[model samples]
Target: MNYRSSELLEKAKYYCNELSKHHILSKYWYELALVLKGSTARGNSDQYSDIDLVFFCDKNILDRIVKDYYDEGLISREDGIFLPLPEWIGHYNLESYDDLIGYFKEKNYPQIWEYTNIIILHDELNRFSGIVEEYNNYVFQDMITDIKEKYLSLQLTLDWLRHPLKRGDELSVILHCSKIIRLICQLSYLIDEKTYPHDKWLFYYLKQTEFGNRNENKIKELGKNIINNSIPLQVDKELDEYSQYVLAESIITDLKNQIQLKYGNEPWLDEWYSFV
Candidate 1:
């Protein structure tokens, strides 16, 4: 962690002590409070950042804590406000693992792992670790595959849009590119669910996840180039028309190789390419 991050965590510690002074939710002083998102941010100073703290506790204690904080007007949309997890989601039952799982499943949420895999604060025994582990094992594979399939389909669509006859088709291709970028960020969060910088998390997480691969440098270049140069095109410009096709082609090709290594190829690999 950087110096700014360390200082932010220290500030969070001070916040916890302040809460303990209230006595209304003092029982949670002993609760686990693991900090996250030290490296997955863009800002250089603590003045621009909010320290993320995930506190795991009993349901009753959590309820009392939320009530006390809200009563104190600590939770708000403005900066430096302390938001209880339930208020952030606009739902209140997160203390129950079953309820949280069911809610995410029902919403078809992509960041289930994020909400479930909170960093514990004070519990030395690491009781909440198993919650994250269970979802990673059971939910991760399907989410990865779903994202892969969506990218593949978008690739085929973009490839088709490359034909001269499909002038207006480029608009749809751009929409699909937006979806692909959003999905990539969401999947990367599941792959690296430690924290949230909101904007910078996806880029940092993707880079970290791809760091050990031989193709990491190439993948980084492609992603950065697409975002920097290709994303701001006008609807009818030639740059906008061709950029999606090429960008989608590059992303699909790189992801195919990665997926093949991670998930292996099937007998119908060539046929699947044609189908895509």
Candidate 2:
């Protein structure tokens, strides 16, 4: 963690502790989970980074707590983001996840994805931890129980690879390789049941997953070769785009087989009709 992140974390911890001690919340304190999220939780904080906190608890309790936070000026203003808090500032969002589950009876991927990237400062009731592990075994279709759409995407993108390589179309070859690699990367996160944060961090954190860790070197090599295709169309006599086809082919092939071996391939076939 960088200096600003470390310092922000400390201040956040203190603020939460204070909130717990206040007369308004002391009794219900244990029920609350003070979740540190966003850029700070990702440990890439700068002075300008706004600290976001998620409050997970019962609706009544959360309502009370949010009102208190606002009254103390401990919560932020809607006017604009607080500039680098050289001093203590309140958490910007009174984000509540469980309260959503209570109202809606389910959680969505966007919510799940946010919860996945968190620094849980406090979860005395032990609710947030269980929610985090809601993802397991295989990725859900939009976090639904039955969806194998990710693999279908992987297979389709994989199929496109052969044509470009056969035709020796340099641009098409590069485009297909890029898409295949991205699909594989997406599937890696789905298999591991983690959120693909979808930015520079997409690949950075992919290597942290069970699938990505095991195939780290291969993924890195493939990524490097594909990305080395220079922009503005530099022709390299030395480089052959077909070289990547074998590597990508191997990756998708292995992933496809393993997923079928473990989960069986019926979900996509059964549910795909609805999609079409």
- Could you say which candidate leads in TM-score? 1
Worst 10 residues of 2 by lDDT: 77-86
Please report, in order, the local distance difference test score of every candidate based on alpha carbons: 0.47, 0.63
Give candidate 1 regions above 4 Å deviation. Answer: 27-47, 58-119, 124-126, 133-136, 139-148, 151-153, 156-174, 182-199, 211-241, 267-276
lDDT computed for candidate 2: 0.63
lDDT digits (tens) for residues 139-188 of candidate 1? 44455555555445645554555543144444455455555555444444
The best candidate by lDDT is: 2
Error of 1 at 210 (Å): 3.9
TM-score of each: 0.59, 0.57
Checking candidate 1 for backbone clashes, the offending pairs are 32-121, 32-122, 32-123, 33-121, 33-122, 34-120, 34-121
> Which RMSD values do the candidates have, in order?
6.9, 6.7
